[model samples]
Target: MDKRLLDILCCPVTKSPVRLLAENELLALNRAIAADQVLNGAGARVTGAFSGGLITRDARTIYRVEDDIPVMLADEAVATSQLTDFPRS
Candidate 1:
């Protein structure tokens, strides 16, 4: 992600600052996805793992970056609370 874009992007719901997910954090999220345990705010299953992502500062939600494009849709945000073992920053 571009520094300028990351600086400007914020969580659509919380309006909180967003930061790139750390390697460990991304791994944990992917593990949860593989278990079929990750879900979007809209209650839809997150069937695919993110190659990259931005997470809200509060760690409440995450927006996936696919092919270098950020999926900023509110409904597409994955709730961290749904993960069995949520990663800490």
Candidate 2:
């Protein structure tokens, strides 16, 4: 991801600052089983967000990652809380 781009990205819902997780960090986060893991829409997996993944502490909304670029459009994000509950197969 580009710093210039990241400097301009914001959370979809809160419109707040976002942090980009490293690939390994994302992988580890993806592996986490939140207390409500089974209730999230995307399930408990970080595959959707990785080195190129952007997250806001307010919520786990994830913008799309394409070509190593994170799509920070509000409409293109998935909440982290919502994503941290899917069963990985």
Q: Which ten residues in a row are the worst by lDDT in model 1? A: 80-89
TM-score, one value per model: 0.94, 0.53
Estimate every model's Cα lDDT from 0 to 1: 0.89, 0.55
Best by TM-score: 1
Model 1 C-alpha lDDT per residue in residues 5-61, reported as the tens digit of each score:
999999877799999988888999999999988888788998998999999989988
| TM-score quality measure for candidate 2 | 0.53
How much lDDT does candidate 1 score?
0.89
**Quick one: how many clashes does candidate 1 have?**
0
Q: Deviation in angstroms for 5 in model 1?
A: 0.6
